[model samples]
Target: MKVGIIGIGHMGQAIIDGLLNTMKSEELILSNHRINDAMTTYQEEHQIEVVTDNQSVINANPDFVIFTTPAPVTLAVMQEFKTLSAQTVILSAAAGISLAEINAILPEQPVALLMPNTPVAVNHGTLGVALNEYITDSEPIESFLQQLGDVFITSEREFGIFGTVTGCGPAFVDVFMAALGDAAVKNGLNRELAYQAAASMVKGSASLMQETNIAPDVLKDQVTTPGGSTIRGVVALEQHAFRAAVIDAVEASNG
Candidate 1:
């Protein structure tokens, strides 16, 4: 498959890297608003073909065109390519842009709205997708997305909430891990050891949650013995309203 990507920014580059590493595409065409020295270096390092104009990208006639530009710019680009081949599946990774809004720019085109996070660069991304009514389900697209990472199909309304969780969840987890590492360092462990220990513990705990069908509360109970060290840690977290704070953070992101 030939894939064309518009707006070669961080997220755009991430998707390009993921696709180049995982999929067998005949060619990958990329276009950006303004080329910089850094972007030129990236293109040379990655051996990707960089186009100078928006029309050049459309003229490439790729099977799929991914729009990684910001929401406002995406509409303008879509308007410019309003006459793209009907078979082309247009996918947008811009956050806060709805499938309806995308379809409004190209009323007859098949469009899919996708929310993918930075984890995609590591092939562990969690993506949520929603397609416009004009586009029927296609197995190839789902299979292609699965190659990047775990993917879920959601309604437009649920897309924003899921983005708050999986799209923004990694940074949230990183913040807690950093705090845990700091505490471990204060307790005499070296900085590197402290960070590794905290990170590995979190990874193992997440794996346990996935492997075991137990609820998180049940898992917590299993770890927290009566009047034990685990219970003491839990008590401290509760006193600090850790769970409430995390929930509020997610709510703020969704808003």
Candidate 2:
């Protein structure tokens, strides 16, 4: 299937990385403001078609066109794209640009507002998705999304909260993991091993909760024994207002 990608920034490249896993290089049509040496080499090495104009990508008649550009850029390009109709699905990763805003620009076309994070490069991201009313057949697009990450299907109204948590949560987890590594270093563990250990533990713990269908509190209880070291650490975290701080962080991000 032919896929058109507008913008070749970090997020755009990440999304392309995920798409490349499921699609051949030739299947993608990329358009950017200016082509540099890096992009020249990228397209040559990957054998992907690269265009300097948005209209050129549009002319390819792709099944879907994903916009990873800034909101203003996406809108500017959409305004200039007179021929984009309902045949191509519009999936945009421009944050805070609502579906209504997009539909206002192109009233009769199908559009989906997508909030994605950096991990999508590795196909392990969590994406916030909201499809417009024009999208009647969701299965194809949703299945297409599964190739990238966990798809959180919700109303566009809920995207703000979902974007804050999933989009910003990765950075929060990285901070927590770094703190854990520092503590481990003080206990005589090597820095590299400490980071790996912390990451592995976090991954395993998350998988346990998911696979067992158990609540976080119940899972924590299973790991904590009476007067155990785990409980001591947990209690220390609680005393430091870790939970409250997390809630505050989410609130701050959403705001």
Candidate 3:
């Protein structure tokens, strides 16, 4: 199936990277408001068609037309494509745009909302998807989404929290790792090695938690001896209100 993409921002690029493995280069068409050096390089490297105008993307007869424009620009882009056939499915990845808003403008068209993180570049992303009434069978879309990573079907209301946990969680984890890496450097470890080790530890710990189905607290307790350094570090985090800070971060993202 032909798929057209409008906008090539970070999320858009990540999605393109994931789709390239599942779809043929000739089946993909991309467009941006203005082509930059990066866009030119991406087009050359991927060998995908990059059209000059939005209309040309739709003219390509794509089954799926994905809009990865900024939230503020999403509605305008949809309005511009108002004449598109109802047979085409529209997918939006803008952060704050909702299905109701999309349907209000293009009432006959099927629309899908997706919030995917940057890790889609590595094909290990988490995507939160919400479909409108027009979409009857999700298997086709779900199959494509699975290629990116895990898929969580959720309501628009829950998408905010999903965005917080999966979309923004990576940055939070990076911040935590940077802190640990800083401490490691202070203790005489090479800065690059410290960062690499910290990332590996976090990745392995998360994998372990998922594979073993162990509660985080249980795992933490198992690793912490009565008077051990692990317990001391845990206590220090508690004293500094680390848990509360993370909760606040999620809440802030939701708002």
Candidate 4:
């Protein structure tokens, strides 16, 4: 039940953080392409095996190997593996790379493409996944992803949209949260407390929406009284075309 990682960047570290909750450090092995002080400190703190080359991690024969490399070089790095076990399930977290491209390199391999947002570091990630034909059992893969956060399995065609909305979503939310925090600060609240309050409210609002399964507009209506401040704020948002701006933001990312 070994898990091999071919990059030790932020996403890779987040994956390791989640995997550690379910597996021992000894079961995880990583390849550090550009090791530095941070990598050295992380390795020391986690006590996980670190290798210099990609093949070393491959030679470890992990049941699951994830590639978190840059999209452009992901395939080339994958090509380093000449042969792998039929049971090995390869996953690419690099955006824009697809299963078909990966299959071109290792035609017989089972592969998947996933886009996990930065929230994964906090174990509240939104992940978009698509599997190829060779992956017969997804329990292992889904189970693996669940350790980090919620998983959405979709077709490759829709994966890009899912990636754009969720992958690019965190930064959008951060901007909104920061604005809220700035408002609070302008109103005299402490900066740290302002951000915490804004984040908590956002988290609670999202959870309430998910748990109640209510449409966002319906939820807004539920909170907006006929002449209340909530309605005033909602009206202001609509007047300013916030929704249209968000839609455009997602569409603009099609590149």
Candidate 5:
């Protein structure tokens, strides 16, 4: 199947990279509003076709057209392409844009809203997908999305919360890693070594949680034996309300 993506920004490029790395499509068409020099460099480096005009993307006659532009631009582009009959499925990766809003714009077409995080570039992304009432149990789309990453089908209302977690979670984890690395650096460890250790520990901890299927509290108990160093660290974290702060940050992002 042919797939066309509009607005080849960071997220759009990430999705295109995921698709090209996984699926063998008949054709992949990409377009951006600016078509700057950097885009030309990317096209040459990746051997992907780039279109300067928005209408060119619609003219590609893709089975699926993914709108990765910002919300305002996405609405405008959808309005422009509303007359195109060749585009069957409309997928929007824009945050804050609801499936209902998309349906209202294209009333006759099938629309799906997706929230895909940056980790899609590494094939480990967490994606939340919500389909309009027109789409029911589409196995092909599911199979296609699975190639990009782990896919979760959810209601539109839940999409914002899930998006905050999966979409914004990577940066949050990175912040924690950076803080750990900074602490290690203050202890006289080389910055590179500190970062390497911090990153590896985080990865291992995540893997343990995934493989064991145990609650994080149970795992913390296993490490925080009586009068241990881990217990001391936990006590400090509790004193500082670390968990509460993280929760508040997540909640604030959704708001």
Candidate 6:
């Protein structure tokens, strides 16, 4: 299938990386408003065609066109292709844009909103997908998305919250991990080892949660014996309003 990508930014590049393993490079066409060294480097490394303008991408008449540009840019690009054939499926990775908004600009077009995190670069990220009524067969797109990570089909109303948790959660986890490393450093571990230990612990904890299908509180209780150091640390976190802070962070991201 002929696929066109409209930008080469971080998310755009990640999508390209994920697709290359599944789709033929020659069947893909990429175009950017401003082609930078990174885009040029990627083009040369992958030996894929990189056109100079959006019109070239539209002219290609690809079956699938992914708009990886910013929200404002996506709107502008849709306007530029307002007369695009209804047969093409339009997917956007812009966060604030909604399916209704896209349909307003291009009615009857198959529009889907995809929210993916940076970890998609490593093929283990979370993706939130919301398809419009115009999309009759989502299997092809969903199958391709599954190659990058777990894809959750949701309503447009739920897509933003999904992004808040999976997309913004990475930064929150990084901050918590940094604090863990700092505490280990205070306890005499070297900086590198401290970070490694903190990261590994979090990774294992997440895997354990998935494998055991246990609630976080239950897992916490399992790890904390009476008067144990773990319970003491948990008490300190509770005293500091850790849970409330994390909750507020997710809410803030949603806003």
Q: Per-residue CA lDDT of candidate 3, range 141-161, in tens? A: 888778788888888778778
Q: CA lDDT of each candidate? A: 0.84, 0.87, 0.88, 0.87, 0.84, 0.86
Residues 1-255 of candidate 5: C-alpha lDDT, one tens digit per residue: 778889899999888888888765347878888767899898888888788686786777787888899887788778888776633788899888877787787886878888999878777788888888888766767787787888998888888899999888898999999999999999999999999999899879888998999999999999998999999999999999999989998988878
Question: Best lDDT goes to which candidate?
Answer: 3
Clashing pairs in 5: none
RMSD of 2: 1.6
> Weakest 10 consecutive residues, lDDT, candidate 4?
48-57
Rank ordering of all candidates by lDDT, starting from the highest: 3, 2, 4, 6, 5, 1
TM-score for each candidate, following the candidate numbering: 0.93, 0.94, 0.93, 0.95, 0.91, 0.90
Measured with C-alpha atoms, the lDDT of residue 118 in candidate 6 is 77
**What's the TM for model 2?**
0.94
Q: Weakest 10 consecutive residues, lDDT, candidate 5?
A: 80-89
- Cα error of candidate 6 at position 100, Å: 1.6
After superposing candidate 4 on the true structure, give the runs of residues whose Cα lies further than 4 Å from its correct spot.
none
Give the CA lDDT, 0 to 100, for residue 205 in model 1. Answer: 86
**Clashing residue pairs, candidate 1?**
none
What's model 1's TM-score?
0.93
The residue ranges of model 5 lying beyond 4 angstroms of the native Cα positions read 24-26, 84-87
Candidate 4 lDDT tens digits, 3-50? 888888888888888778777988887887878888889989988767
Model 4 earns a TM-score of 0.95
